[model samples]
Target: MSYPSLAPYIQKRPWLMRWMRPLSEWYFDNAGYRKLGLRADDLIPEEDEMVQLALKRLSPKEAYDRVFRMRRAFQDYPYLSPLVKEVMAEQTEREDLESMVINKRKAAGEKKAH
Candidate 1:
């Protein structure tokens, strides 16, 4: 499951972005995944459908790189999370389209004429 975030809001305000940048970096740095050579996105569970789809969409090189990093405990920038988000958004849109109900309302003038 994806967690809700204030990242968009914080990013839109330069002052807030500046204030949070160091704190966010500090948190990520101390989170210990890097020590294990795992990027932040690597922590996302593979049980998620979006994540699974994103993994499939990964380029061969990226896929290989991810495996290599995990094997060697090497660290890298985030790559999968953005793809997962894209997949999730596409799925949500598809679901919304499938579930949409269109209502056709007759005009008052047409009813009167009938």
Candidate 2:
């Protein structure tokens, strides 16, 4: 499931971005993850299947970097989110295609019965 985010909305409006920039930075700075040297994405749990799949899809170097950052408590950045989104999108597409196929089969069966 896709979560709603204001990022794109704020980015499209220069004034909003300007206003939110400092506040966002302040929040992030004080969010305690920075103190721990962890990125925002690092806080995301690995228990989710989507996240697990995303991790599996990462390049060897990227996977190593993720482990290194976690072990070293490095600063935060969103590295895995895009891959997670892609995985979710692919799943949704597959589901939709499967449903379409099922519906088509049902329609064909009904036509033959008539």
Candidate 3:
């Protein structure tokens, strides 16, 4: 799963958020994605199966818009970030579970062989 972020903690403190807002804005602006007509989420790699599944789940209009943005950015997308994050988290969890199961099965098989 995606590591826990400090973002929520920082955001919950009004003073910290206020202090960080300008710096965050500056960072975002300078990141250059906007110049490429891409949102921060658009930079996420789509090679993951989770990402592909999330793309498939997008609404038709949203999917069309995402494609258009990607084409524009190539010359890139709101629900996208949350959806991507959720998928990534799920994928990680699944991987972890699969590894645990495999390890258990391997250990059991080794015991049987011995």
Candidate 4:
């Protein structure tokens, strides 16, 4: 079967999907390491689970608040570890938007005034 076919199968079989998390993790850990990879490290769990884990270890509201706070701070965390410096370099580089829009508009205004 192809990947597209598996989507509906997994959706229709929630129990099967739940059971396959470990297998999926294993597949991601090896061949798919960069993306579907980092199985153990990428386990963000879910909102409710984070809340429950937080409540169990801390307080109910505290856990909820902490989860959201962490999410806002580190949601891009998965890519940051490897891509932080690279992303910073890109952000500082020449702006495509500036070249296309600002320069074009300036030329157009000059032509109109002439």
What digit string (tens of lDDT, one per residue) describes model 2 on residues 19-110? 99999999999876677667777777798889999989999998887788798764455567899999999999998988884333455446
Tell me the tens digit of each residue's lDDT in model 3 across 1-114: 254778999989999999999998899889876776677667667888788898899999988888888897665334368999999999999989888843334554465644
Query: Which scores greater on TM-score, model 1 or model 4?
Result: 1
Give stretches of model 4 more than 4 Å off. Answer: 1-25, 31-46, 49-79, 96-114
Clashes of each: 1, 2, 2, 0
Give the root-mean-square deviation of each candidate in angstroms. 15.4, 15.2, 14.8, 11.2
Error of 4 at 33 (Å): 9.8
List the lowest-lDDT window of 10 residues for candidate 4.
Answer: 33-42
Can you give the TM-score per candidate against the true fold? 0.56, 0.51, 0.53, 0.27
Instruction: Please write out the lDDT profile of model 4 over residues 1-114, one tens digit for every residue.
Output: 112447578868989989887887787666543442233323445456554564577657765665566565454446555698887767666565456654444664465655
Q: Identify the superior model by lDDT, candidate 1 or candidate 4.
A: 1
Between the candidate structures 2 and 3, which one is better when assessed by TM-score? 3
Could you tell me how far off, in angstroms, the CA of residue 60 lies in candidate 4 after the best superposition? 16
Q: Write the per-residue lDDT of candidate 1 for residues 2-112, one digit (tens) a residue.
A: 889898899899999999999998998897776777887777788989999999999999999888878675345566789999999999999999999999988877754
Report residue 113 deviation for candidate 3 (angstroms).
Answer: 75
